[model samples]
Every structure is written in structure tokens, then in C-alpha cells.
Target: MEAGEPTSLQIEKQSLHDQVASRIRDLIIEGHLEPGSRIDEAKLVEQLGVSRTPFREALRTLAAEGLIVIRPARGSMVRKLSRADVFSMLEVLAEMERLAGRTACERASDSEIAHARDLHERMLEYYRSGERMPYYKLNQEFHTFIASLSRNETLCEIQGNIMARLKRIRFIGNSEPEHWRAAVDDHEEMMDALAARDGQRLGDIMAHHLSETWQRVKNVI
Candidate 1:
């Protein structure tokens, strides 16, 4: 066997768990599985056509990411982040994005910045066509790209976790026309800052952008 190779059984298990997790994640983010509601493992397993083992493994993974809560006897429920909890999460996310912006500005290669611009342009096209879902997904991709530009895997992973936790609220915000337009405008400014390699400016812009996002989602939270 080759060094560092995963056995077929291990690979199959990982694939099942990951697929289960992704399905549940989309359900949560799309609000099909409401927050604070108990997850019906039997029903979900039947509906998703998956077995109990992978379903349970997926629940554990979501719990670690703050998307689900496991209680003694009560079983697993979709986590409901309180207003305070939401704000605290946003605060940390804001700082993480600020750091990402600053670091990317300082260290991102020209090709990286160009790639970001390309993403922004594609996102703008979606916005222009009034394709809300595609625009929203591209918007997230654009931010994730910026986080990658920081060249810090730990920071990127932290950003992913927080974003995943807040994704439901974020989607609601983007569905609003006013907030959606404002978010697109912020992305434009972010691109400009990145183009100029202005770390401080990009950081400040990211902080403000996050604040606006919080405001937009405050009603839902």
C-alpha cells in the first residue's frame, strides 16, 4: 500500500458522512430545518436515503460547527443562536474578515487579486440579471477567495465555521433588495482596495461591511 493512502472502507465512510453533512447543511441554511427544532433522525434518514451511521456522524460534525446541539435524552436539535450570540459571532467574523483583508492586501499575489476581480465581475453579472441565488452564492465565493488570499489555513477554517453558522441569516439579508444592493456596493469597494494593495483601507471597509450586514440581519435574529 502507498504511504498516507486511505483504505477503501475509510474512503467510503468519509464520502457517506460528507454527503450526509452537505445535505443537512443545505437544509439548515435554507431554513427547511428550522432553528431550535429537533432533528427527526428516522425521517431524515428515510428521506435522504442514507443509513443511521452516516447520519449520526453528520450530526456530530454539525454540532462541532455550532449548527446543531446534542443534549442528553433530548437528542439533537438545530442550534438557535440568540441575538446576543449572533452579535458575538458576527463580531468575531468581522475581525476575522478584517484580518483577512489586511493580510491579503499585504501578501496576496497579483494573480490572486486579479482572480478576485474576475469573481466580482461574475457576481455583478448575476446581480444585473436579477439572479438572487446565484449572486448570493458567488458573493460568498468572492469572500472565501479573499480569505484564501490571506494564505492562512487556520484563519480560513475559522472563517468557514463562523460563516456556516450565520449562513441562514446571511441568506435572508441577501434576499432583501436594499441590503443586497448595499452588499454589492461593498464588494465593489473591497475590490478597489485590493487592487490598490491598501491593507488598512481594505480592513476598515471590511469592518464597516460586516457592521452593515449585522444591521441587515438584526430583524431576522
Candidate 2:
């Protein structure tokens, strides 16, 4: 075996868990599962066509990720974000996005920068067209692209975790037209900083951008 290669059993186990996790994650993120709803393990296992073992493992994995809370007698429920949780998470997201923007400005290639600009423009069009769902999806992709362009895997992972945790709150904000427009404008500023390749300015802009979102959504969450 190669020094870095995983054993066959290990690879299989990871694949099983990831498959199970992805199915469950989709349900939660798409709002089908609903926050604070009880997870019916029997129903989920039937729907996913997986057995108890893998289903339970997937639940444990999600619990570890802070997406769900498993209580002993009460069973598993989707994690509810308190107002405080929203504020604290936004604070962390602001810092993470700032780091991502700074690194992207420093390390992203010209092609990467151009791609980010294209995504931003496309999202703006979607926003203007009043296609809320598509715009929201594209908006998420744009931020993720910028994070990936930073070329720091750890930073990207951290931002991904933050995004996952905040997805429900973000959806709440997006449902409001005024907040949606404000978010689009912030993305424009972020794109401008990336175009200039000014790491310092990009960092500051990203932090402020996330901070504004926190301000807008904290009271509602």
C-alpha cells in the first residue's frame, strides 16, 4: 500500500457515512426537515434505503458537526439557532471571510478573480429578475468560490462550517427583499476589492460585509 493510501475498509466506511450524511444534510438545508423537528430514524432509514447502523452513524456525524443535537431519551432533533448563536456565528464568519478575502487577494490567480466577477454579475442579474431561490444559491456559490480561491484549505473548511450552521438564518434574511438587495450590494463591493487585488482592503470589506448581515439577521433569529 502507498504510504498515504487509506485501507479499503476505511475508504468504504467513509463513503457510507458521507452518502448518509449528504442525504440528511440536503433535507435540513433545503428546509424539508425544519429546525427543532424530531428526526424519525425509522422513516429516514426507510426513505434513504439504509440500515440502522449507517443511519445511526450519520446522525452521530451530524451531531458532531453541530447540525443536530441528540438527546438520550428525547432522540435527535435539528439544532435550533438562538439569537445569541446567530450573533456569535456571524462574528466568527466575519473573521473567517476577512481571512479568506485577504488570502484570495494575495494568492488567487487572474482567472480565479475573473470567475468571481462573473459569478457576482450573474447573481446580480438573478437578484434583479426576482428569482429569489436561484439568486440565493448563486450568492452562496460566489462566496464559496472566493473562499476556495484563497487556496487555504483550512480557511475554506472553516468558512464552509460557518455557512452550514448559518444556512437557515440566511434563508430567513433572503426572504426579505430589503435585506436581499443589501446583501447583493455587499457582494459587489467584495468583487471590486478582489478585482483590485488589495488584500488589506478586501479583508476590511469582507469583515464589514458579514457584520452587516449579522446586524440585519440577529434580531430575527
Candidate 3:
């Protein structure tokens, strides 16, 4: 009964679809629904205890995020990232990250740098503990924070989308002890560059780091 406030029914419906989409996303991330395998819509609908409408909406959301594909006759399926696909996405990601590094070096505030430093420390703790999942999550946050420090909305949006597409593969890249340690070292270098306000150096380092990361992912996948 208030302006700009969603009705209870509207709130409930939003909750339903968000829950459904989150579940499907987790399933895909956990590899329960293998890449390139078609999603069984009817089966998922039954299992999720939802009707066709919300289930379809959830699939469409994932499709938009590049997690799934919805073909005309074939239906929705988890997206399979080929070597080329991964490379292309990584190429864009590298450039975006490079730009973020350069811009953040010039524009990032002391507070922002401190925030990143805190995240870096936490990530190191996760790495030392051998908690891959938590470390990966922190890894994502660290990159995202750098992007935000860029102060460029377009770059951040583009970088975020590409990162989302590469999430599952990037996690796999961390499966190797050597690769993971190298990535952490790269982060340390990036932090140094940011603190010193060396835009060009940070940009170069960011590009090379992402390229090396792609090599690791390529070898594994």
C-alpha cells in the first residue's frame, strides 16, 4: 500500500525466479549439468518444483550470461567453451584488465587501494589454506575491485560480463598448484604497480598476467 514499494505478490514472484536461476547457475558451476549437454527442461522443472514459466526464465537468464545456449529446435544446454572461444574471451578480458590497471593507477583513491590490499591478504590466507573455492571467489573480487577503481562504467560492465562467462574455466585454471601460485604472484605485482601509480607498468603486467593465465587454462581445458 505504498508508492514505489512492490506488492507482496510481486516480491514473491521475484524471489521465486531469483532462487530458480541461482540454483541452475550453481548446478552448472558444480558441473552437475555438463557442458555441451542439453538441459532437460521437463526434468528440471519437475525437480525444481516449478512450472514451465519460471524454469524457462531461469534458462534464458543463464543463456544471456553465456552459461547456456537456447537453440530453436534443440532447446537449452550448457555452453561448451572451445579453445578458440576461451582465447577470444581472454583476449578481450586482457585488454579490459589492462585498461583497468592503467586507469586505476591514475585514479584510484587511497581508500580503494587499501580495500584491494585487504582483499589480497585474505586471498593469500585462502591460498595458504588450500581452499580453492574461497580463494577463487576472492580472486574474482580482487579483479572486480580493480575494474571498479578504473572509474569507467563501460569497461567495468564489459569486463564483468566476460569474467562471468569465464568463471567456470578460470576456476579450473586454479586446479594446478604452480598455476595458482603464479597467479598470486601476479596479483602481488599488480598491487605494487597500483600503489606506485605506474599506469603503463600496471597495464603491461595485467596483460601478461591474463595471457599466462589463459595458457594454464588452455593446457587444462
Q: Which residue pairs does candidate 3 place in steric collision?
A: none
For model 2, what is the alpha-carbon lDDT of residue 53?
Answer: 86
- State, as a TM-score between 0 and 1, how close model 1 is to the true structure: 0.84
* Backbone atom clashes (below 3 Å) for every candidate: 0, 0, 0
Candidate 2 vs candidate 3: which has greater lDDT? 3
- Candidate 3 wrongly placed segments (more than 4 Å): 1-16, 42-53
Better of 1 and 3 by TM-score: 1
> Lowest-scoring 10 consecutive residues by lDDT in candidate 2?
2-11
RMSD (Å) per prediction:
8.2, 9.1, 8.0
TM-score of 3: 0.83
Residue-pair clashes, model 1: 0
lDDT tens digits, residue span 1-221, model 1? 12432222122334478888877876787677889989988877766777889889999999888899989888899999898988888899999999999999998999988999999999999999998767877878888889999999999999998887887777778777888898888889999999999999898898888888788888787
Output the number of the TM-score-best candidate: 1
Instruction: Quantify all predictions' global Cα lDDT against the true fold.
Output: 0.84, 0.80, 0.84
Q: Model 2 misses residue 196 by how many Å? A: 1.5
